[model samples]
Target: MGQASFACDPAQTRGRRVAEEESAFRSCFQRDRDRIIHSSAFRRLKHKTQVFVEHEGDFYRTRLTHSIEVAQVARTISGALGLNTDLTEAVALAHDLGHTPFGHTGEDALNALMQPYGGFDHNAQTVRIVTELEKHYADFDGLNLTWDTLEGIAKHNGPVGDPVPYALAAYNALHDLELHSHAGAEAQVAALSDDVAYTNHDLHDGLRAGLFTEDQIAALPIIGAAYGEVDARYPGLEPYRRRHEALRRVFGAMVADLIDTSRDALAGSGCAGAQAIRDLGRPVIAFSDRLRGDLKEIRAFLFQRMYRAPSVMAQREKVTKVVEDLFPLYMSDPGLLPGRWQRDVAQAATDAALARFVADYIAGMTDRFALQEHARLTGTHVLGDLT
Candidate 1:
């Protein structure tokens, strides 16, 4: 499909921080997407857990799987809206690169530990990874992504206000991201697609984990109608088939709702171009009010039954201790960090700078690596492979 007037045009991109000859065979956004796929940080997402710990089950969504799903959903939404699917997919896939090993639990623990230094924000860490940490390139420290992609990465969730995140602030000072404005429509699509993918897939994972029953979730708003529709159409279906059919419908409803609602908004918004969309100061891509309310109920249900279940909480405590233990040890003995990371520690001019190096090293660890390191360093004969 031809892109809409308000779609981000690769030809008109704000350009990379470090200028490079344009690719003859691909758009800049496509190159950005390909770069993210090949990134070392992206590779580590394979073992980064989301709601379920990586060791608990192979079927549950790791950050890698979730990112791929979000990218898929974002591409569909972007295509339907005649937005730039490449940019959308790039933003979607790169969105979670900064997530710590054990997911939000680990991020939270690490943030608390680093509070004395500068604190941790996964979003900021994501920006850091793309802009600075990926040092493979000879021309620059990071992937050296275009300004458009950088803005999308930094502000996809929304605008940055006072006390902007340290990593982002540092980078933005070098190349301003227009921090107090909404990212373009493609980024907005990526952000909402994250919601759609997670809400739908988390329901699937929750059911598979037996954290909550199908009958229980069937009582929730949008899901109830979905279950009812599945029951009417496939009355005698096997339990597995019934659940799968109903949840697929739920997923369809979310994607459909997002596309339809955003299509209407775009038609009415009088946006002349992508820049106009950015200046609108509101997310044009979003679910309808009805679906938004339905999602709130679903999320609350998950928070109680899935996220905060006793078993999950117990695992959270243990993993939290892993981060807590890892940070200070690495901080006190910079020698403990791997040899490759030693150069950063030796050059540290302050305790805070050294702590940041430690944060960067620990934050990059995969779940299994973090667990193994914790066991080896702290003398806990635990799961070497959290499988």
Candidate 2:
């Protein structure tokens, strides 16, 4: 199928941060996707948590699996909307690169610790990872990704404005990402696709973890309707099959709604080019208002039942202390950092700069790594001795 006139055309990308020869066969966006997949930051996501601590159990979703699911959803939505699937996949895969090890809990701890050091924002950290942290290239420090990919990741939620995260603002000064404007249509599709993947998977993971039961979820809005339909068709189905069948239907409904709503928005906007979609001042990709309302109820239920459950909170308290203790220790003596990271610490000229470097070192750790390092330094195990 032909692309929409407003789709992000790979041939027309704004080019990489450090200019280089274009690929012989692959498109710019495809190269960005490949680079992200091969990055160490992306690999670390394997041991990063989505909801539960990484060591809690292998059954729960980790950031790596979550990113793959987001990419799958984004590609489907982008293909349906005639957007650039490669660019959408690139954004989806790289969106969570800067997330700390213990999920949002680790991020919250780091953000609080760094409050005096310009604070921690994962979106900004992602920009830093692509633009400054990764050092694989011969000529450049970070992966020299195209402007489109960078912008999409930076503004994954929306446009950046005043009070921007220090990392993002610093990079933006050198190479402007049009921080005040919306990202391309492909990026918008990727952003909404993240919402869809996380919302549905959290429910699935929650059920699998026994935080809530199928019967309880069967009373929620969209989920309830899905379970009702499944029961009517496959009466007295096996519990495992019934749960999978119902959740898959809920997932399908969300995807279909997103595609339909996006198509309507695109047709009504009369955008003639990719830039026109960005200039429209509102996202063209989104869930319908009714679905959005239903999702809110589902999220509220998850928040109370799964995220805030006593078991999870206990793990959260442990991991929070791991981050809290590690930051101060590394800051007080940069020599404590591993050999590779110590080089950067040695080159720091000011206390604040040193703190930032330490923050970056801590932020890049996997959940297991953080706990291990904390135990090594303090002789106190956060998650107990690893088997």
Candidate 3:
């Protein structure tokens, strides 16, 4: 049997390592999970949008809930395969910490606004949050996470394009090498788990918000079948209750399929249970051809019915404008900012720092807070920038 370098302590999953007992606090992966939990960026996720705006309703999935759901799905798959559940959960939790107030609408606006400065990417900004932006301890700039967790977040997109400047170059380089060679199954699980959560949960949120009718939801083939399977599996629920039950059923199926497919692929590769498989440096998951096709079909159905709907797009437009206006006004003159950031603004000069400062500021706000800031600056309910 191969020796295991780390130990798992479920109770200490989110505890940090201090100077006194840095050797025994938690596993490297566990420390990564804990660091994410304690970071300011993670806390800000509570206010960010998921599929619906924060004000859309109290029950809509905020970025926090979305992160939690993704973590749950990722851990389920990872645990099923004897992978690192804590690591997967941590990565999933921190994945959206850099998301702006209004979800992707805000993200798009931030990208446009910050295009001149290295550009804005939630994934990139997530790295910045842990390694640079966050100010928790006196010794470091970011969270000072473990090499593996940092790599997972940095190369979450895999070897697609563009290189991330990781804090640990060796680990980063190793991960990059692994990607071209194959891809990390755990990272792939985390990525696809996100898709699974969004595919089913967003549809559920939309239906609950009155954005779509039962007939509309049931009309989509993949979604309908998933719902039917759930109903048959556990019947005798009221209509309102059925939607939530169906959502769980769909998510469960996605998780199950991902785990089974990943296991089969690993088995086929003749490296079913090896430490080498765990160190999958790349960002791809090797799924059987059948499961891949099914995932793609499910994604396509969601794109047609949920993501691209005119009603949703219209709201997204409104969300886009809110972020676009709020960012620049604060960037140009952060003296207008509240709390400690205003003090930091008084010390900085030049546009780069200002842009980053603004990015940090905007990224930290909730949907309501962003709106309020807009109202305070523009004197109108609509979003705007003051010079």
- Model 2: lDDT equals 0.91
Q: What lDDT tens digits, residue by residue, belong to model 3 across residues 74-131?
A: 8877777766677777778888877888888887888788877666777767866877
- Residue 345, model 1, lDDT: 82
Task: Please report, in order, the local distance difference test score of every candidate based on alpha carbons.
Answer: 0.91, 0.91, 0.68
CA shift at 68, candidate 3, in angstroms? 1.0
Order of all candidates by TM-score, from best down to worst? 2, 1, 3
**Model 2 regions more than 4 Å off:** none
Q: Which ten residues in a row have the lowest lDDT in candidate 3?
A: 1-10
> lDDT per residue, candidate 1, 1-387, as tens digits?
789999999999999988999899999999999999999999999999998777877899999999999999999999999999999999999999998989999999989988887789999999999999999988899898888888998898988887887778888899999999999999999998999889888899988988999989999998999989988998889999999999989999999999999999999899989999999978898899999999999999999999999988988988999999999898889999989888878999999999888899889998888998998899873444443
The TM-score, computed over Cα atoms with residue i paired to residue i, of candidate 1 is: 0.98
Pairs that collide, model 1: none
On TM-score, the stronger of 2 and 3 is: 2
TM-score of each: 0.98, 0.98, 0.83
C-alpha positional error of residue 300 in candidate 1 after TM-score superposition, expressed in Å: 0.7
